[model samples]
Target: MSVCKHIRNQGYSQREFLVLRRWAIYPHPSVPHYTNKLFTHHELQHSDYLSQLCIGYRHILFWARWVVTVIWRCIFCAYHKLFGRKYTPLPPIEDLALVQSATTLAEWIRRGKRSAESVVRAYIHRIQTVNATLNALVDERFAAALEEAREVDHRLASLTKQEREALADSHPLLGVPFTCKDNIKLTDMNHTGGIVSRRGIKAEQDAVVVARLRMAGAVPLGVSNVPELAMWCETSCTMYGRTNNPYDVTRTPGGSSGGEAALLSSCGTALSIGTDVGGSIRIPSFCCGTFGHKPTSGWVSLEGAGLFPDALNDSFGIQVVGPMCRCARDLTLALQVMAPHAAKDLASKVQHTDLRDLKFWWCEGLDTPLCSPLDPALRHALTAATHYLSTTFEAPLEKLEWPRDMSIATLMWNNKLRDDYRGQPPMTVDMTNRKGRVSLLAEGLRWLCGRGRFTFPLLMMATFQKLLAVNEDPQDSPHYWKPMQEFLMGTLGKTGVLLLPTLPQLAFLHHEFVPNMLDFGHTCIFNTTEMPVTAVPLGLSKDRLPLGLQVVVSPGQDHISLAVAQALEDKFGGWVSPVPVTV
Candidate 1:
């Protein structure tokens, strides 16, 4: 295949590859374990094992031919870049008049000061005004939202004083407006999930996450866009288009939670839900200035979602449903309602988790299989953040040694991805394709390597670990796999949270990834590790885009991370609203 055809069949170019890499698709400088030597694809040329597994490249050839047919389309983009109209201006932050903190937003509805109808309508208007430029909401339910809001208002009007208070007190999220990943099911919305083939499938029942959100009295505004099957980081799907960052329309909002992040950044919804199998939630939250929580596995239900749901095996431990919002407290609020609980008893009494006595283990490096090099601004921001945390909290942050066996985790995650793929239909692998070759052979090597020590099932399970991959972003290098829990637990004593940069860089132009090699640097490691990570926006980068910090708590220790987030927010106003007078 010609280079262009080869690139086209990849569904993206080397430029696209670099773009995805920078957006956390591959290793970067921050992830210390990601060595350039390992990514040297030439090393794989000698693997006889790979030659044995090569398969037909017909489909790739077809896509390549199609790509060649459409190569001229690039001229349109080039013409536009050179002389076409500039981007549409973002709504001036000043245009925003009514601002609601997560706390105040909920309180307004509870106090009957702002009817759900009005609140939802206001958001609908905001989405209407902004979504054209952002492509944030894949499908909107304005009519249904209004009806639901009206019903909520009417119910409030008819309730007795005690009844109203009881009802209000019951659903903290009552009358609040929210949205979720299109991969997630809602009653009327088509659950496209950015996959064209799945674009027309209407959900018969709400996904467990949606059901929980609605049962808390929240109205679903609509479904947000996501990546194709949420496979890539930047949220561009052939079906719904790309979701832009609120900070810079030219930049990606990050995915597979990009749409939700964009919506949250624009204040289009009070709260939203997103799934994270491999940094899907955290990366978007990092890209768009927002607070997102990836709760511990099984803390929230993933029963009805479609984006890579099969990956969650009976013993699978990497995926989760989490909240995305603009404030730290909002995350806490969302988590309470979202935690696995009956709809009637959604109130979370798990508050007051103090941070004063918390122990923290700060991991400064990217700690992935990629070299996660941070932008200078991101580095400065992170340095400032570390200084503030150590100085203000009077808590000396200790730096932990880098784990050596991190690739073990990446290998495990590769196996998980392979198993997930195999569990699905048509288990065909044309290993002739570079991507397939890497996935299949890497998984096989892991399985074969461990056969001496494990049973068939156990060996397979061991092949795909929930461990942190340190050698490279699992998606980038054939060798990018690692398992590091034994090391982490050994060093950190299995307590306190691990603090790191949410990403190595601030948001960049949409195609910046074209030139960079960094891939899902920090976030994917956690996905592989199956650890709970909370991403909180720290402040804007020098370039004016958002910078976020991540806190990784021991599995099931999400509460501790939230406490730290809350404390950090208090110290450094988390998720600062842009000067809210949008033009």
Candidate 2:
């Protein structure tokens, strides 16, 4: 049978037949015209049959390619895991303090100048030496960290020089040790958030930001402590006790991410991942005298990093995961790795605004009653920072008032908390069971008697939540929040950066924050507005406590706040190491 008759018997559509006929008659453009004339009808029919067979074969090959790709990926991954490069012994790094920034450390590792194992060992040794007195690390994964470092070293050593260079180009954070706030999850780590009830719960997998950091070759040392539920700005919980400031063990290191900041400040770790809703990250960074950037809301993924199961949805617009580092450049590097797409878009637009070309709006304090008067030393630090910027950058500085009413900001923040926890059982519920017994109260009384299972601040925060519940008027919140949001976004939009006090006073003595919790008004304003804020250390106070300022900018302009932080770091000498305390 002719090829056309055979196709018709096989049920080929008239459209298909016409297409084949046209192709056969005209020939493909690539085929020679003379060759087309030489083919008789029988030859054309055979060619058409062959073409159909080729089409069928191509479909089979397409599916086969996918299977082969999948199998190859599996084999490659298994092989890489089994036979990856091994760590080479190196001369002891006598002073780990030399590797100040993750950026520089990663560059050195990529260049084959430093072994990943050495970097990990340096941080582990520092943690061992200081963590006893600082109490910064809630848990230590020394063995696991060392093993991962060895794996990294092995992988690099196995690669050719060119392959090593390619890996370095891909993994900018290669071989750097970093800490994660206890609230930010890492597989097999205790994500306690400092709550006793969660003491045994392990994260099933890494949080999105944690996974990204690992992909970029950053090794996690372990989880750091936080206040119970991370609600208060003091790093004390029934689970891990308290994390003291490296500068003065007598004072707080700031809570939530306090341990992360303390570790970074004390040079126990080079980089850390922290979250901020109402200054959790920045407050601790300020207290510890380190650099921290609270990225624009939703800029960093919150997957697997939640206090409650529904934390992401609950704290939708306010909460964010961000980077904390001893150096400003590491903040940008970590952010880029954590949120590659957003950071890329931000980098494209955020040219470093030369200090001379930048405009500054300075606010000494908030107008709200909640704002505590800035300490004399803190006031002086801000003044000095302003003066340094003005003189060094020759930039203009204008004294700007805290816009959009502080009362409204407070109300909006409270409303957010209310909305965040609405319908969910109160934290007090964690202390009760099916019997309805309030274990927390019993624990609180025991605590009063010096045998408590819960910390004082956690108990106070729970009681305060009840009081707030009684006073909450969610209906009235939007009325105030809408205008405040509009005013803030309009005032600081893109070009402007607001410099404000990170805290009313320097790191206060432990437990002092309980009565003065409202003092967070200065920091909470930006949280409520969802704007990016970077806490930059402005040297130390007269008492030797860390002094700092908050650089605020509009949403998605994280680079602006970070740029200002870098500039300020250059002038003020960022993150002066605390004198190590002997236990």
Candidate 3:
């Protein structure tokens, strides 16, 4: 398309105008001397004009990102100046039960060292104490949860030691407490997914994963918050406002599983159930200083929980429900309860692998779409870990390589979701409901005045998704998606693992993701590959917020990633309680 049509199609926003003017006025250093010296009137005729114009456009777009960043940073500063520290500070974890892992908690409850009722009550109190500050626990089932706890205690009291061992094998987490993300239904609890129109809705039944956990004797504490339809990375919506990070309430807790991570980090719950499509589960875990695992594709059921389709695995991957926890071992325990049929086999695979037999590869970000640079703290932490692994384990941490050409990565992803397929979401008309698709133009304009029914991030998502030019020949590009999978699977093989910064940067202030939305490709691309990943909290940054990295392994290797997470926990402390970050 020509520049004129491009501007007309874009509607010439302020940023576009600035970019066009800069492109026309600037003389790129790489341009020949004759162009600047004698071709002022004949520049368009120059051989490099189009290529240089493309370069100049890219240059201006790069600067435009920073300009948007400065603008958002200023808004944050003004907010603090006016609000005078409005968010409440979370009290440090004072109860011993709140600090223990779900795995340990359950063992204690079964062995009679602790009462199941007391453990449930401890989490209930912590959630009550922090929800006012974190806005994470959106709906509670405290009374019901307490009742369930009593039953667990009563049942265990009658069981013989041999029976308890059998119970431990059959129901590993019997008496542990866990929170559920709002999108993952909890019977009689809020199921809004942060959409204002869906405000009064409640779930009639537990999601499949939730049911499994319940059957295993785990008690449900509450439902956590989410972005609209679980689309955005930072958790906030018109219905539930925004969920804040406990370490620094001024920043985000990453979404759409953000609420669960924040609650776990703040000692509100030892474990939680959350769904991931892009990096929903891992991103929040990264920001909150907790552990989260996105299981191998189809390893966990999505029934009654996920809004996205499952066919993405056969075509281009997208959704799965997985466990998020404070400690790494709890991830293994939770997955066993959630997918008991596959537990024994997976346990055997994970136990057989040794770190010495594994190879390591690391990548800063995806080669296709541009990601914001990793924060210095994130970079330093990842580098340090790589160094430790290479020296401590006597393995080389080599740089990862991408396929020769991956420009089609974004198109393939968009086409898969946009194409007609079974189980496909109603993206043809987003913000959909019983009423139907919303008018993007109308809703987007209303949002400008701060009176819209949807959040800006949700609208932004709607706009970008609709803007993808429909692919009339999606069949021709199925081959394009293969290179990434082949490269990842072939290189990693069975026992190999790849390391990546959990995200490009540490968690930013709420809404700051608007300008850098494309960065999610870092996590989304992995989802498309169906690889299993565990987000491990390395430690705190200089600013006291969480710093983390992704430990990705070949498909069907969920346990390998989990095992590595446990090893990391031993080498570097995992899931430290968040302290207030004055900054």
Top candidate (lDDT): 3
Clashing pairs in 3: none
Task: For candidate 2, write residues 1-583 as lDDT tens digits.
Answer: 4445644564545645554443332222222221222234455455766556434454464356445444544564465457643322122225743446888898888777889898899888888777777777877789999999999988888888887778655898999999898888888888777766666878888998999999999999998888877878888877787788878776789978998988888778889888888999889999999999988887788887875656575247778889999888788888889999889745434445565766778888664444455678988889888887778877778886432234445556766666555666676775431124345567778998988767777677677666667544554543234445555676666677788898877786677675567777777777776788999998887778999999988887787788778888887889886763233
- Higher-TM-score candidate of 1 and 3: 3
Question: In model 2, where is the ten-residue run with the lowest total lDDT?
Answer: 27-36
For all predicted structures, in order, the TM-scores are 0.74, 0.79, 0.85
What are the per-residue Cα lDDT tens digits for candidate 3 across 402-461? Answer: 532233445545554454353444542546653577888999789888789998888877
Q: Provide the lDDT at 271 for model 2.
A: 94
Candidate 1 worst ten-residue window by lDDT: 426-435
What is the model-wide C-alpha lDDT for candidate 2?
0.74
Give the winner by TM-score: 1 or 2. Answer: 2
Clashes of 1: 54
Which stretches in model 3 have alpha-carbon errors above 4 Å?
Answer: 1-75, 81-85, 307-316, 367-369, 404-412, 419-425, 428-430, 469-471, 477-480, 580-583
Error of 3 at 577 (Å): 0.5
lDDT of candidates 1 onward, in order: 0.65, 0.74, 0.76
